[model samples]
Target: MLEPQPTRSEAAARPELTREMLEMVFDHVENGIYLVDGQGVTLAVNRTYEEMSGFTNVQLVGRRLDEMVGPDNLFSGSASLLVLQRKGPVTATYSTSTGRKLLVKGRPIFGDWGEIRYVINTIWDLTVVQYSQKIDADTARSQMLSEEDIITCSEKMMSVVDLALRVAQTDSTLLLSGESGVGKSLLAKLVHRSSERRAKPLMQINCGAIPESLIESELFGYEPGAFTGADRRGKPGLFEMAQGGTVFLDEISELPLHLQSKLLGVIQDRSFMKIGGREPMTVDVRIIAATNRELMDLVRQGRFREDLFYRLNVVPIKLPPLRERRDDIPLLVRYFADKFNRRHRCYKQLSDELVQRLQSLPWQGNIRELENLVERLIVTTAEEIITPADAQLEPQEPELDPDATLGEMMARQERTIILSAWKKHRTTRRIAAALGISQASAARKLKRALESDIGAENQS
Candidate 1:
């Protein structure tokens, strides 16, 4: 008896063509191609496909797609199942036993009667692409880490760095704004270091950390015996000492309204007078100011001088928060872990689970918090692998009294709820949605929560 007539697809495989012609046509193609029956039983594979799969024709043909996949198989899952599920095209990525990544596209061809006839698959090796991306990322991370110790995989942070470097070319006053602990200070230093004034002194003065009355003396040096407890020799101010260099005024928003006017004059005239000296000592100094608080809000509230804000904000860089750049967390974690390990003379690394857990945290304190946690874990934990359970990580916050007033109770509860929601949803927009409030309100609440004396619980 004559053999059953082959379907159109099956006939096209041969189509009165010689085996040599088919082999030449299939083998000459660069991409891998394989064909299977409707039941996903491998019918044939080209030389490229065999080489890609690391399987010979005898090993693949007549075996079902499911049967071909095993623990030791080149590819893990079956794209055939996807095609079978929808009876249509399916595209997926799979890893080979040799560690190469393959992008496979499977398409089904229907017979004359509309029945499934053949499933043709095309595979492209993505190992080159994967390796290229890994290399580029590594190179960028290395350069950034070396220059500024900033470990970031997110494009947002990279863009910020790019902008900062460009702004560093000249003596333009740069204003960096972001959430607290978001590396504003570090970026300020980066700007200073990248600028042409790197040879000169780079002075950092925290406006908020210093006493209100002494801010003036700290900024502009006083004459000998200018006031009570004055230095007899009289020291030069940061602006005077930072001549031809950068003066980073961190927490600039905390500057008093009166001092803001003095700072504005210095920025405009490039000179500032000593507190008790009659002569105005002229000095060329580059100013790079940073504040976690919104200067606009402060200006509107009359807490920050609008003119000074405009002067300092000549070039603004908004450093992205840790939540917005969660992609960098792993890199940061590994860096900090290695850092503290070496510093503490202990070798400790975060387990995969612990890393994932840390990545999921709100990180309101941003990079500083992460660094502290890594160091704390390294110094505290004895084990080499720090797991989630082993770390027993809890965010530090100010505690409330059991018999506190209603206002205190409400503040404590509000902080808790806001932080919890913020943790679950990393974005202010999402947090607003979750809490049924405007994005601005959500941001204000988060800021207030973070500032609340919650860490005071430790003191009690």
Candidate 2:
């Protein structure tokens, strides 16, 4: 026999059930959800948020995010506030006072009149994971072109990636300006993969790497007998070869001034003439240019064409250097270590001391330098655990007093180690983990070390 079902009248009588269901769903969601009004006042926070942040709705529901974020408050920063300021979506990563690092993506909801009504912030924990688990080398290499390979936890780099992904759908020319080894080429590949012309080819040419004499022929293929060494049969240039695709012009600022005008013509008319050819050949291709030097500076110096600069600068994306995004160093270290370990068919893990030491370096060569260092360490280190001593980095030691007692010398050494760790890993929990101590002990020792340093500085 079929069980009796509730009638419309019976269901309507218990309207509270609908509200209860919504509340249950909100609380049970996996990711933390934070809702804020346009005025920046916290509207609601789900149970997930409370669990993740260790703050209840009663404390956050009526509070302003700005008031809650500070050195002495619940958060160090708020992405929802950034969205309200920019009137757009924002993705940011920040550490909480609770020692939890979080990645928050805040999206604004616009009202009928185009004003922002609310901002919804979705949060994800970015805490570093243990490196004991091994990754498959083949699987890691296979994701090189995919989004997963671009490992970054820094907010600045996140914003850059966000902008790149957003602009990938359009056909506008892009100018990627950044220091070398900042992953400009990788980003260009990402843009191509994410574009409408993903099925089409992505032709790459380094303007600086090629000899100036043959650059014209390489970019715009010569007609038969156009030049002494020209092929008998005319060939298609990059613009033609990359038909319905993208042409990544690496180190574009190095292109000779004479070629800039021709490049501009291709940008303006979507056509270019082959060497020794009278008629222009039409082509459909997107242009993505990268440069390490400042194009504007070169323009003022008359080295680069202003018109061409403006053409390629339609959508400029400047990637921050690795040094500027230091928060990503540990993550990058782990990634490269895993990558090389898989490649070499050996399992190796980086010691906390070495990782902390790496974080303190200037990294003038940026990500390229870090990757090379990690690979070198992985292959060269004899043991399964790679340490700072294995890397042969200069030891950071405190100056000793000739007449000081053994206990005093030991105290000085301890202070030096604790201070150095504090410089690289700011949080007490991280410092404690790096130094193999309890969080409470780390905090107490750090405070005493700081006070002693201050006293010494005063005396000096």
The per-model lDDT (C-alpha) reads: 0.76, 0.81
Location of the lowest summed lDDT over 10 successive residues in candidate 1: 137-146
* Residue runs of model 2 more than 4 Å from their true location after superposition: 1-148, 395-460
lDDT score at residue 232, model 1, on the 0-100 scale: 80
Q: Write the per-residue lDDT of candidate 2 for residues 1-460, one digit (tens) a residue.
A: 9989999999878757578899999999977999999999999999998888888899999898878865566886677876776676666556667766565778899999989999999876543222222322312311223222455667898889779878988999999988878989878876776677876767778888778886787788778888776667765666666778788899998899999999999999999899999988999999999998889989998999999999999999999999898877877786677668867878899998888889998885689899999999989999999988889887756567899988999988889889998997788976886678999999999999999999999999
> Can you write out model 1's per-residue Cα lDDT over 1-460, one digit (the tens) per residue?
9989999898888757789888898887988998888888988888887777787899888988876654565446566655665566655456667765565667789999976788888776543211111212211211111122444546688678668867887889999999879988777766666567765666778887788887787788788878777778676676776677777888898899899999999999988789988888898889988887778987897888888989998998999989998877876787677657756778788998899989899897899999998998899887888988767865545566778987987777898899888787777876886679999999999888766646666568
Give the TM-score of each candidate: 0.57, 0.58
Which model scores highest in TM-score? 2
Can you give the lDDT of residue 217 in candidate 2?
A: 75
Q: Pick the candidate with the highest lDDT.
A: 2
Clashing pairs in 1: 397-454, 397-455, 398-454, 398-455
TM-score of model 2 vs. true structure: 0.58
